[model samples]
Target: MALPSRASGGRPSARATDTALTLVVTAVVVAWTVVAMQYEDEPLSSTLVGWALIGVGCGALHFRRRHPVAVAVVTLAVSTVYYPLSAYDGPLMVTFALALYTASAEGRFTAAVALGVITLLAVGFGEAHQTGGNRQIDDTSLFMLAGWLISLVAIGRAQRTRTAYLHEVEQRALAAEREQEARARESATEERLRIARELHDVLGHSISLINVQSSAALHKLGKKPEPSAALTTAEEALEAVKATSKDALRELRATLGVLRQADEAAPTAPTSGLDRLDELVERARSTGIEVRTRTEGTPRPLPPPLDLAAYRIVQESLTNVTRHAQAQSALVTIAFTDADIRVRIDDDGRGSADEQAVGSGIRGMAERAKAFGGELTAENTADGFRVSARLPLTTIGGTQG
Candidate 1:
């Protein structure tokens, strides 16, 4: 059979180790054979044939790792014939034992077992038929030999099983690493989207109001160029613009602090939450859109993420009212209960019913609500457009009672 590329030359260190081992086996076998012959009066031709068989048997082991079954068979055949024909019975069975071990370690257990059985039977039968004054193979010798072969096979099988188990563990570790990397990438994407939503809510509301006030100021000043009246209107519009711009810049800076590296300073300004709902309402009212806000039930402190999500949902909803629903007035109702908080915004404007389905502002609000295990619904009501959200209240753990 053809050898795999890995078995032939994958590891240089393994090749070197195997070469040294083969040399050692060859030396031990040759030395034992020479010593045994010193006591036996064997003929020159018989000794020469024994030496040739020893050379072939030991040399075949060089490719044992690559072709374990073939080597095991060759060595077994050589050893079986050598004991019967050679006068000097040296340690020729050692080479066959090593080959059997290699076969078992290489995952050729069935072949190794078959070769071992054949070797035992052939050697036993040959010893039974011999009549010369040679060293006899007794029952104890056969039992000892069987014990040695079984031990080698057991040890080799254990090594094979250990190697397989280690390989499976490494594969499991690699799979876990890949899953962790995928989760990390998903988290990064969600963070980017969150930052984008924050920027939009912060900047969009202020800029839209600024544009409306500026346009109104210019129109009033142009229609009636009376210095007394136009200057006063211009002054009020500019003041509103200045205040809105400053708030926008502060919030923008705070939101962007999340993008800074770990070593850099974070923005110290407190995050906007329910405490700043009045400020948000005032800003929306500045654009001549009457914003009425009311609270129901008792007010309580909320977890930071839940509070932030609640505030953003309201802010984005009001911003949408100013930009899309040309309504003159809107009502925001916040209701706090023992288990959850609800916020509802209703505007009496002729806005498109499909706006809530397609608008990014509405989508961002829904995402925020979902992140907190809450729910949001935006739909056209009999009066106009309505956006409502209900967020559960709990401790730091994201569970709702």
Candidate 2:
């Protein structure tokens, strides 16, 4: 957007052409108007003076945009003196017209209009001077002069209007492009969050359940010498393993189904946000996990994305507890404030986590928190592992509905 390369046609810039064309036309008009003196029809002194004045007038047209009003006035004055002195019979509207247009288009409307009026008077004086002694101003001459001046001013104003309109249209196009890009980025982020939530829930829950089952089976075999108890424990562990694996597969399918063609319906089951957190707790309870959930401030509704992120953080942390912390009890605390919300998970067990070093679950939770301008921290304490997060209400706020 910054670099001005070219027009859409991939051609060289047209500004150069415009400048060249303007100067060329100005040169031609000046030459044609003064050709009478050049053809030896006027006195040598008058012709030389006329040439000098014409040069002064036409040469200033090149820098019109820079000092439009000033240059235009100077050129108009010079041309008026030259036109009458040389008694050149030609339309004296070339340089003045160009200068007036440039001045008005560059936002000097008053000066340009005043210049136009003065130029008309100058032309009238030149015409009267052409008629030897007594000359009465004719209506046709005055009307023609007025018409030319008005047309030039109107054209200049119209040019200004067209430029302003083009600029406005360009600004609107840029704004729309930025809006579209923002929407695209948001859609991509939402899709990523959806996939991450599904995977974190599926893998965290299944792996934790599998780890618990295996730990139970291992515990039962070594602690007891009875074959009947060991067999029952092994069968229970296998059943849990089978159920967890199947659930993981089903959830994976459901999550990926959204990527299919729109004609084919994906699963219509509601996504698990904070509303389904109770069901999550019950599932943990089924795995012999004792969870204590507490709330410290008044709870307000959350937007779906944030609610899902919050729920997934809790779910992943609890899953970590079930997987690694061989703790009998775990605590989850949710604190809400007018401007912010804090979530904390603590488990009192041997603290070595399942995937302790940069686990996918932890990374997903961190990503979710970061997406909403929040932060998450996890570390081992004296008692067990702790995962704490803080999210801003202003950034992630909306009603549940």
Candidate 3:
């Protein structure tokens, strides 16, 4: 069987205090009854029975919190009977006060009011009966009843105030938790988008260079007379691969460095739009892959993100050709229209049915285009695969820095 819950575990200090109070009050009541019997010359039997009733009524105090209404009713009944018979005041009045307090504290306001009324009536009627018709309404009894009623109302108000305070605290806690969860989710989404951007920048450029260099090396190898030249071309291509891998690692490490250190430095600057297109194409030509480049309309400076996005689209398309297509040549077209800049990479490569599911390269390219308020489309035509992207110049800004 399971242990009791934390809420059910009795408060040791509170329970001990209650028990001590009950014991002390019981002793006092018994002593008072004995003294009253000696002074009034009452019989010993009457005093003894009164002491027993007070003791029994005091026992009800232990269960006040658990059964406030019942305890209150029982104490009121016993006090009504024992008050007239005993010369001294009984413990029932004290017990009744405690019962009223417990009822308010435990959220039983209706029961507390009823008990208070009953107690006042019993006290008034018992006094009137004891003195016969000669007894008059006195200030002492009125004052005592007023004090009890005030105490009951005061306890009820205090309990209500505490309950309101606790409810407000709970609402604030729930709101804070919800806000924290929202912030975490937002941070995760931003990180994912940042990673996508980095992958597009790194892989797109590196793979394009590899495709170009490998083609150049293969062409030289075919010449048979240029073994040394072919070897040099292969070496250069390998060097490019190593450089690409190093750059990728550096970017990745920078992104993840925050997890390891509190004072890590920021990442290095990224490559921007159309900065090294000439060198990129030339390197590929040095290999065996033939690339033709064309530009239409006046070439204007573009936003950093748009320029980088344009570069990535072409780079990824060329990389795909080198890896999957057996084509001999590729074409890169850039058109600066009145409102937008358009890019297209066409290659004479074997197109497969699952072109969209090629690799992360395509997905990264698409993500880059979307980030800049642009669109990317890929289609496998009869001759080869085509990748195209269009970005609005107005939305992203004028040019790369």
Candidate 4:
């Protein structure tokens, strides 16, 4: 027989199947040996020896999975030695089919085919082929033996094919699941970064304004000796602080509302965009920072996402002017082109290199520009610090892909 191959199907229930095959084959062999002795007058011990040999051969079949070829060879050899020597004149052979099935299922094709042919030749020499009065019965038994061998081999081959197919399908399913998990993790990371940027824009601007207003109120309350003048300045500072705090709370609530949404629906209130640029510029002006706004092209409405990004860029820039630029004057310029929108924020503040602080505001603005298939650059110019962004109009707004 061909050498044994690795089968995809695992071992069969060994104990039950092996025990059943052994019992059935042993009974048949013992019955045949005893009846043959009736004609030969052989001693009972001789009959028992034949039965013991048949039992041992059947027991070897138990190792068919790990050593199919070896089991088939041993079983065939044992049967050959006992069958012809026992003077058997009957068609009583059985049990050897186990080795043949296993060989065809797990063995190489050439080896299994050769082993089958050899086994058929051995069957031809058995008592089943001997011419006698019971020739019809013996011939029938021989025919059945050939058919059983063919059927068993076919069954084994099919089992191997099915087991291999199942294993392949299982592997593909696991791979698909793993890939899905990886995509989910990547999406979660992107969402977290977006939330961080929103919080930074809201907190950084509001806190800077609040700090400025509180300091001014404290100064006016102590510096001016006149009760009415001092009271008026302090009240104005307090009013500014209250307005800043309220706006901060409103913006923070809107940002957090995105997380509370359970479905894809429009937000209850509109988000900030270029339309709010006036308020932003006025806020900086209130802090004694002279501001100028300029437009190069005809003003037109922009897509929502691009508009929001543009507003944040100007807002964060002005906030920086208050915190680090230490500039007395700033310029906000916006240009609309056929294919893209351009934004520039320039400050004539402490133009020193040390005035530039590349922090979360800058990174967040750059990331926002990138979202719309755009780019942003921040650098210290001789006049002051300049932050510029170019956003492509092609995919500027609407829902993200």
| Pairs of residues at least 3 apart in sequence or in different chains that clash in candidate 2 | none
| TM-scores, each model vs. reference | 0.81, 0.67, 0.72, 0.79
lDDT of 3 at 80: 72
Q: After superposition, how far is residue 33 of candidate 1 from its true place, in Å?
A: 8.4
Candidate 2 matches the true fold with a TM-score of 0.67
> Which candidate, 2 or 3, would have the higher TM-score against the true structure?
3
Candidates 1 and 4, the one with greater lDDT: 1
Candidates' lDDT values, in order?
A: 0.83, 0.74, 0.69, 0.74
lDDT of 4 at 221: 78
Worst 10 residues of 1 by lDDT: 1-10
Which ranges of candidate 2 are over 4 A from the true structure?
1-15, 30-40, 87-92, 123-137, 218-236, 261-264, 268-320, 329-401
TM-score (C-alpha, index-matched) for candidate 4: 0.79
RMSD of each: 4.5, 6.6, 5.6, 4.9
User: What's the alpha carbon RMSD for model 2?
Assistant: 6.6
Residue-level lDDT tens digits of model 4 in 380-399: 88898899999898885422
- Candidate 3, residues 240-306: lDDT per residue as tens digits? 6666556556545644543455576655645535766775565455446799999999998876667
lDDT of 1 by residue, 1-401 (tens): 22232334465665677788889999999998888878887788888889999999988888888889999988988887888789888887788898999898888988888887877787678678777836487889988877878888888788777767776787899999999999899878877788888888888778887887788788888898778788899899999899889989988988888888999987898888999999999988888889999999999998877888888888888888877888999999999999899999999988875764456388878877887777899999899999999888853333211
Q: What TM-score does prediction 3 earn?
A: 0.72
Candidate 3 colliding pairs: 212-284, 215-287, 215-288, 216-287, 216-288, 273-307, 302-399
On the 0 to 100 scale, the lDDT of residue 105 in model 1 is 84
